[model samples]
Target chain A: MAMPFEARYRVYWHHTDGAGIAHFSRILAIVEQAEEDFYASKGLLHVHGRLPRREVYASFLYPLRRGDEVLVRIWADEVRRRAVRYRFEILNLTAGRKAAEGHVVAVCVDSEGGELKAVECPQEFVEAWKEA
Target chain B: MAMPFEARYRVYWHHTDGAGIAHFSRILAIVEQAEEDFYASKGLLHVHGRLPRREVYASFLYPLRRGDEVLVRIWADEVRRRAVRYRFEILNLTAGRKAAEGHVVAVCVDSEGGELKAVECPQEFVEAWKEA
Candidate 1:
């Protein structure tokens, strides 16, 4: 199996809640950022904004605090004709533990005539994954 | 089974992405807001921030845009000794459809001496759910 693509982020004040830990909702945003970086690194920036999430899930194992740096790793676990499922893990480098892990299923859609129509994955996306 | 508690929210510019719809990450925040409202309505405001999510999941069925009013309904689907599972639905009142649905599992914890220790549900929490 191919190694997962990784991206690094620092916990910011905006990402933390009153509990002084990164808000659980921010975990999804962090993973999505890693996904974007992965696609951009693969020169598939055109794929951005074309795929919207159909479903997303995350499990929080540890708390992450502001100023802490985290490493996000992502894998294109499943690539289908019309969708892709990306699995991601957010490792708290400061604490040396997994902070959270999740998967997002995004489906390709074409927004033409002000309507969103489900579409097959772009050829570029398929080719990018094939190369990865 | 009892009727779920409901809260209303409007999609704002901050909640939207370049896709012109509410960002998927915002869905979790929206549901959490509803959960907070539910607890507040039950006079269990102390429960806020005491429960951190163990896992969360969401499925988006329709898009919600800026200026759209949404009705979020939440139910304490399962209340255990140390955790609560909340099921929620986001209804797009403007579009008259289910925009998203999800569940969050939060476990009770106590932060004493700077350590997060899993603890039993508060008496107030148990009493609140029992009344519900």
Candidate 2:
């Protein structure tokens, strides 16, 4: 089962440059916020924990302009032994175009804060996420 | 001639993770500050302006741990028509290792906020940076 989450973000002055377009870095911030919300919706409390050994990367396919109303869609794509893969889609509401698409991979780690390790998916949490 | 600028940044709580290491994004922020300082050192006032059509990108080569004092080096590597290339190197002071190496490319844009155009290098500004 996959969990899905949607979020709306407003373009702010801080998010734009003198040309009135969003800086590349600002787009990454919004995608990050959507990912945070995805985890919170899953009923998990590891928001601030050190993510084990997973890596996250993003690429911008199109430039987002300031004052553009955007919608971000997030969902889990797969879950492996100690890792989970998530995907994101950014849509430009005003122009009806796909602005960007990204994916993130996270690995579960031990509580000892040692090396990243694989763990079983918490069935209860997974179920709650599916319901959400 | 190459321009030089140096700035010291402390690893803050918001800059790290549960593993107590600096998050990759925070490193980009530090590098960005250095680039800003580089421009300011040259007496250029377009800090808040839309960088014409120039594109900038960054990559992380190594992980930086929390409480680590890292030094970043920024210098011009090449200049082409309508484009300026800059490079960054992150050094780990405690262990004496190069933490990361990255580069950014910024294009000069027109004042009307239209298409980016390559203008003759501002002779005065470039010379000012040589002395800084």
Candidate 3:
């Protein structure tokens, strides 16, 4: 199990929908951004490693309005030889309530070369995720 | 079960991310647009009834490149008294392949007055979905 990582974000007007709350589809950006920040914290990047997932599942608990501050926490829920699953918990930091949570599963892929193919999880990635 | 509704869309440049393919996050716009078009075909608008759902699950089968043409099909998978679940299938018509599919579950809410609260599915909505 890996420790969860957190980051803060402010909802902008563009994130809202006709409903006046954050659009559920747009939440993908928020979660993916947190995932990127999590890797950057460890001095890693998508260019250094590529793990593209095919599936995403999320549940929104509260409506996030524009100007709302959020605390998004992410962690590896499961790790396999060639795939990893991550969980995200988005909180209304101002209101101190959970707004959404979800999981994303990505498989290791060799995007460095011309053709992208599924690959085994690199040792450095596994080590960084588990040990650090 | 409601019959599936479909609409055609062309991939725009803004939908692409650094990956050069359609950004996963931006796919929301495509799906939501389809949803809106589906309703509009029946002379319905988001303002007609507010169904705000909190859950979304999606799977991308293929990467959608810019300038691609897509066919998005949506249908009601389940319809409850106060909630409805929709399924979306996005096909890359240009490539003759499936790009992605997902499910969105939204609950009915009353926004006419003040204080958004979950409400029962209106008769008109149920009738509109079934009859039309």
- The per-candidate TM-score of the B chain, in the order shown, comes to 0.93, 0.71, 0.87
Off-target runs (Cα >4 Å) in candidate 1 are: A130-132, B130-132
Best by lDDT: 1
Candidate 1 or 3, higher DockQ?
A: 1
Candidate numbers, best lDDT first, in rank order:
1, 3, 2
DockQ of every candidate structure: 0.90, 0.18, 0.64
Model 3, range B1-132, lDDT digits (tens) per residue? 447888999998998776667876677568878777867777676533476666888898877878999999888777777777888999999889898999988788886543467788777666565642
List fnat per candidate, in order.
Answer: 0.93, 0.15, 0.78
Docking class of 1: high
Any residue pairs clashing in model 3, and if so which?
Answer: B53-B106
Could you say which candidate leads in TM-score?
A: 1
Q: Cα miss at A79, model 2 (Å)? A: 5.8
Which residue window of length 10 is worst by lDDT in model 2 chain A?
A47-56
Model 2 residue runs over 4 Å out of place are A1-6, A17-19, A45-48, A52-67, A74-89, A95-107, A110-132, B1-7, B13-23, B44-48, B52-67, B75-79, B84-87, B95-105, B111-132
| Model 3: residues with Cα > 4 Å off, grouped in runs | A111-115, B111-115
lDDT tens digits, residue span A36-121, model 1: 88889988877889888999989999998899999998887788889888788999999999999888999999998755678998
Model 2 chain B weakest 10-residue run by lDDT = B47-56
Which whole-number lDDT from 0 to 100 does residue A103 have in model 1?
A: 88
In TM-score terms, candidate 2 sits at 0.63
Interface RMSD, Å, model 2:
4.6
